[model samples]
Target: MDSVPLFALNDCDVMTTNGSKLGTLENITLNPNTGELKFLCVNPSSEESTEFPQMENGQVVVPVDSVETTREYLIVTAP
Candidate 1:
């Protein structure tokens, strides 16, 4: 797995590598034992959200491996 840079979750916007907006960073899931990040919880934007991954319980769980953080946004790749 590639090393994903640590980022401030609240400071970034979540989008796809293809440039589709998924939403804002809302929460993160972690592995309790290792304290490693597991997934990113995103709150989908009101419009064009259907283009994003299907939401479960009002949020999407983006796998950490698919995320790449830039200075401005969190780019998510397709699973």
Candidate 2:
């Protein structure tokens, strides 16, 4: 794992493992008590994936555990 700053993820595109574009990184979710990552809030850029639940603020919530990589895009699991 590399030491990429969390701020680098801002506005980064998020994609599924199978190559489906979900959206852009809007925010991150974490466990306040432990400061552990929980999920990623993605602003809708495409309606190609619906495996994850969405938020009321129009951002799709993606589990951080499902993320495979974080480079130019946040690669996440399809389901």
Candidate 2 local lDDT, residue 63: 84
Where is model 1 more than 4 Å wrong at Cα? 1-7, 47-56
Per-model clash counts, in order, read 0, 0
Candidate with maximal lDDT: 2
Candidate 1 residue-wise lDDT, 16-79, digit = tens: 8778788888888899999988888888865444433555577777888888877678888876
Q: How accurate locally, in lDDT, is each candidate? A: 0.74, 0.80
Across residues 1-79, which tens digit of lDDT does each residue of candidate 2 receive?
Answer: 2455787887889887778788888888789999888888999886654888987777899888787666688887857
RMSD per prediction, one decimal?
2.9, 1.9
TM-score of 1: 0.77
The residue pairs that clash in candidate 1, if any, are: none
